[model samples]
Target: MSAATLVGSEAPLAQTHDVALVDLDGVAYQGHLPIDHAASSLGAARDGGMRLVFVTNNASREPEDVAAQLSGLDIPTSPDEVMTAAQACAALLATRLEPGAKVLVVGGKGLVTAVERAGFVVVRSADDAPDAVAQGFSPDLGWGDLAEAAYAVAGGAWHVASNRDLSLPTARGFAPGNGSLVAAVVSATGVEPDSAGKPSPTMYRMAVDRLDARRPLVIGDRLDTDLAGARSGGYPGLHVLTGVSSARDAVLAPPGLRPSYLGADLRALLEPHPAPQRADGGWWRCGDRAARVVGDGLEVDRQGPQGIDVVRAACAAAWAAADAGSGPAPQGVADLSA
Candidate 1:
């Protein structure tokens, strides 16, 4: 189907877009647990002829493993429908390194296999004198693993991180993610790593090109990584309030981090997005709901349909204010999400 060039549309995204580049963790599931509406919502999007591509920053798991987990959660995903940061990292390394260059993989099986598949020789330690160091997250990684990565990177090896997500969501709470561990290596080596994950736009563009998506909507919960990547790649993004970011975050987002559309959850794919329009008196309106920024605070007036309209109006109003040299203060944004 030929997709329209429109970003925020009156028609359902399922009908307008050919592909949905979905973020897995907070959008589809929270760790090992399934989301309440995610399975059915994504299934409906698929049935409506939108191809689903599950994009993840987690370099620990393989596509097949992630697919199996989503399938078990009733999402009915295939390995081909999944894209991981591990694969993206490998691709990034391939562009810089020779065909058989040695990469000291300081990650789990997924990252190691991805580097090997990209025609790089995978090594274990700095003692191997590898050409590069690929760092990612693994639950079993001990002090030895960090030391090895630090040693290799300090020895003039190119350091590459799969994703710079500072925290990982688990069933219990947030823990150290790949970025946290990468920081340890950075502390020792005094070197920064080139990432091939979200916020880079490399992974997003790679997924779009691989999937051959003409109109791909980058959907995620984070404003920094997902929406920022979409902005850089010239793709429209739909931000859902399902994970780390909240409705208030969208309102105060800078130009690069702002999403094209806002949704409460995955089911937003099935609905129309009515963008907030500029109204009189420095306000933005979406379906009768209105919002505006007053000094450092934000005001929401004229209530409308519950969930999404408020976010839309708030974002438009706040964005306008910020662009004009006035943004919202933290004290005022707390109630939008609540």
Candidate 2:
């Protein structure tokens, strides 16, 4: 069935106001190459009087490095506006540890520096068991290092992980993330760590604190990390099918991973004075267009690009209808199993 038919009974809370837009990327730039759509969406977010932050789960790089990456992407972002799980892990440790606390940081210099910046004494594997081992993402982790991490955790140090992403997307493909390292420790020491990445309240708390956000909306490409995170934090999430998520995957999200709003890209929400259309047997207005569902899917003949923008219009209409308590027939979009 169509997306509208999926949202059968329960009405989705509608948001007609500005929303906080967060970009999940290590850097907006890669050497001389700029991240596609980074500049435009970020610029649009700023112009719309919306809060914008780059929330990256890549704990391999420090905030400064992330800033430099944005500089490369030609996306202008301040250091304060950048939030990394590496930084969040550090902050969590600092608040709970004593001054001069010994930390066994596994991962990269980013985690090390963040821990040190948080007033914790940094320790490596060569040193004695530290007070904690902050596991962050490291691409070149050695097998021996996994043993070392196990030893650190078994030695009675607190285990903290930057993120639990089993794999991270790269220019090549999916690679192991910091969660892989944390898994080693868990397997060896029988200990699970406190995570500071997506889907964790710790990461959300850090982001909300940094942005001073109130009634903020989570925007992410992944349902597990982004939508689950928002649900865990009791906030609404906007799922944009622009990154790793496929249309089929989105149609089959688990209950906890469902997004309040679904769209194809960032432009659907960031554009100023967009159009409205009739879609999914309903009407939606964004900027100047109306979207309605004509069949199993949305039908938008508006004067703009087809894709995520069109999907956004349809989603907006559905959301509006839901809020008005007169939206589509609820069929649990999560059951689509695309």
Which number leads on TM-score? 1
Kindly report which residue stretches of model 1 are placed more than 4 angstroms away from their true locations once superposed.
Answer: 1-7, 302-306
lDDT over C-alpha atoms for residue 163 of model 2: 85
lDDT of each: 0.86, 0.65
Residue ranges of candidate 2 with Cα displaced over 4 Å: 1-21, 26-35, 271-338
Per-residue lDDT tens digits for candidate 2, residues 17-99, read 33464646322432245545657866765665776667777787877877776756667777777788888888878767897
Residue 28 lDDT in model 1? Answer: 94
Please give each candidate's TM-score: 0.96, 0.74
Every model: Cα RMSD to truth: 2.6, 6.9
